[model samples]
Target: MTSTPPDDFDAVVGAAPSAVTTPTLEHTAEHAAEPRGSRFDDWWARTVYTPARQRLWYWGAPLAVTLLAAVLRLWNLGNPHVLVFDETFYVKDSYTLMHLGYEASWPADADTKFNAGDTDIFTSAPSFVAHPPFGKWMISLGLAVFGAGNSVGWRISTAIVGILAVVLVMLIARRLFRSTLVATIAGLLMAVDGHAIVMSRVALLDGSVMFLALLAFGCLLLDRGWFQRRLDAKVARRRLAGGPADWGPTLWWRPWLLTAAVLLGLCSGVKWSGLYFLAFFAVYVVVVDAVARRRAGIPFWISASILKQGPATFLLMVPLALVTYIATWTGWLVTSGGYYRHWAQTDGQPWAGALNWVPLWFQNLWHYQTAMYGYSINLHVPHPYQANPLTWLFMIRPTSMYYAGSSLGQNGCASANCSSAITSIGNPLIWWAAAACAFYLVYRLARYREWKVGLILMGLAAGYLPWLLYTGRTVFQFYTIAFEPYLILGLAFVISLIIGTRTDAAWRRKRGLLVTAIFLAFVLAISVFFYPLWTGQQVPFWYWQLHIWLPSWR
Candidate 1:
């Protein structure tokens, strides 16, 4: 498989220029080049490489795809007219949060009563929810504008972020792969993928986590380019002045890092699992900085990066993330009705007085954190739809979020028997093929040491590897939605490899394009076939059964 040269930024309009030149980049570009696709290359050069046109594609393509994604996720979004799966928990919590400034409990049969149009469902007492309130607050934003009792309100936020995630992945792929074509394909693939669509159409935390994490990732990518430009400028200045440079430049005004920290903080606000991405990206960014310095001929690059830039990045990211996380609890802290809000006052602990400097609500927040941690860790009850993480990539089993069986003359069933279901399943062609393509990514990382490959792999790992630690706990295939963009990126990266460069032979390039088109066509076909399952549309039972290629999908 072919990998794009790191320093081939010249071929990519609007890419950063680094002062450091390496023999590896020159060699790889030369070796990967073929000499037969002048016509295709000419079109790309004339159309996409023009500065103004490039800008249009950059801004226009993502918005177009986002519109497509929005339409797919929002059509009949209020259907089934009921809270599906975990929406029963989060939608109600969001309703109470908007009204009471915190989540409130409900009656024992709240689901039944609430679905039946009993809008006044919640009790005045606070609920002890394990997750943070920010995601629910996001839901509340939609509920506040669109009425709390409406299904569109329950799901509008996820749908919006879901569309935003499609755009974010496009920008990120553009940065990583340095090809507008690659970015457009990656975004379109994500726009059509059933997994992304399902999570977007539902009221769920994972979709928000996916969008926030991808936003942070895009910020880091921007930071890399911005830092590289600064580094190049500094290196050029030192060389022109003929001064003895001990280490390198110290870049302190890193707005991108802080932006990433803020987004990551929001990610963690949605789910604690986002902390993994925050930690992973912090290490990844610093390492890239060290590598850049070393390649720029700095003798003490490691120490310089660690002592100067490392601390700067840490200060910009970690503390901001911490403060942002604390700020997400403002609703709970300000309200007297929140669960455990008075724990410090009532626990009668010896350290309560010793810790009098801290506010009472802050003290209770700490205690609540401990209790939430325990509750999350101890949740090991078996679930029928729980899938092993090992099977996630293959999509051997996917959870059915909603299902209704009807006989003839029921609910517009035109057949003898029919079923309407909302299944959290991905397009088989995309998910299953991505599993195969990811192996190519591993190979590229090992053989080429492509930094972008490593970054994409880190995303996949951060979103996926943590689940391995909880193998005994109930986990679902839907959790993969958080990292689904990376898989699409991996697939796009592989397809780019197949398509090779503009220099590749005409026949080889055309053949590769054909293969890619055929594969995408297969994916689109599968998605169409499974669309009924994704959106809870009624289909003949045999047609629904036909979509279940594997018995586990049942």
Candidate 2:
């Protein structure tokens, strides 16, 4: 991607024109022709895409880099030889769903047999699992091939999706910031980050949620770019060639946004939390569209954006999500013998025969859903490691997913001291800085009305802040997986800021980037250094203790 320096004074490059370009309006006039993607086409489209004129590397390099991430995440994979965290739930459930057509309960120690490649004891009954079946269905895809014997069966799908997510984030960051360097950095950070790594290795519903939600987010960004391009092209055709171009650009059936909605619904199908992000982003898309329309100077932009954009987002997300969500319950629908297979028939509700001959089991499933919703909202249990969302940014507490007893000699500990632990502690270097960045984002959002700040805040709010509303819940630190991607992105955004301001002197800016790069290198080194502890690698006690930066970490 060879190109010239994009100086603030180089005409049509800065919000604040260079002192040199000030006395002469020559520079601004020339860049006005540059369009979205770079400094060449309709240059005045600063608020939108800038057409790229210089040499640029394609997606090949990003793909290769993503493969490297996959190697790290998927290698070994089945160590500790046990379900690390919620794998206990998702892995076993997925196996039953595949074998029995519904999630059925297993013995208390079923993980031991399942780990040892023995699933013969699992029954052929519909299990009363809480979550929707999509995530389990995915897990079962791997188990069906790998046979639920080891972590490979449970984890391979998630690990693959996790690495693919890195690729998606890179592609997304590349488009959003218009910087290959930023995109690579985001991918590189995700490659080794603790939360992404740990979650990938465990067969957890949250990781699936993370993958689908992030996928949807990525798709919407692309959809935004595609929509704007069509809008501009349509407007140009009308103004230049003379036609009404009435309906404000045909962006009716946005495929990517629809993909996002299906993914979002599936995400909620995995867990109810996806509903919040779906609701938020649906509105977010419409608002972004309206603003883009207004800026483009369409005569009836307001009505057009609402009428055209709003309904499509609704159609894509709400109904599509509902359908996908319902489909996840088909296993319950078809089954005659379930946990609550006859509640409506026995209790004899008015709508008991509403879908007459639909089977009493199906009616009981609906009743179970009503009861489940009640339980989820009214949950008020307190917990020991229950962290406040307020403290999430600080990495003050991390969940220990596994710990076992063994002598130092038995587990290869150097001085008769043995310790085996899989903790969900985040990279301190990245997280501590992100907390400061969060405050900075808050200030910038209020001052400049920057959309970047708002996006980060919204993600964090949906992931972290909402927990404030449920301070009474018995949540654990491992729940951070829900929002860890945004946290990582927040850190990456701050690092971009550290890479020097466009307003800084050229030499100073270069130096700032150098320092930032070195800082990121250290963070990467730390991730690799602690990889042993993050996964259940057998390391000496003293070696493990060295990684414990605080007493709480120990």
Structural similarity to truth (TM-score) of each candidate: 0.90, 0.83
Task: Please report, in order, the local distance difference test score of every candidate based on alpha carbons.
Answer: 0.83, 0.70
**Predictions: Cα RMSD each:** 5.0, 6.6
Model 2, residue 281: distance off in Å is 0.7
How do the residues 314-429 of candidate 2 rate in per-residue lDDT, one tens digit apiece? 87779988888777777666765555666676655626345676755556767787777777777667755566665667777777777765565675655566667777777777
For this target, which candidate reaches the highest lDDT against the unseen true structure?
A: 1
- By TM-score, the best candidate is 1
RMSD of 1: 5.0
Pairs of residues clashing in candidate 1: 34-503
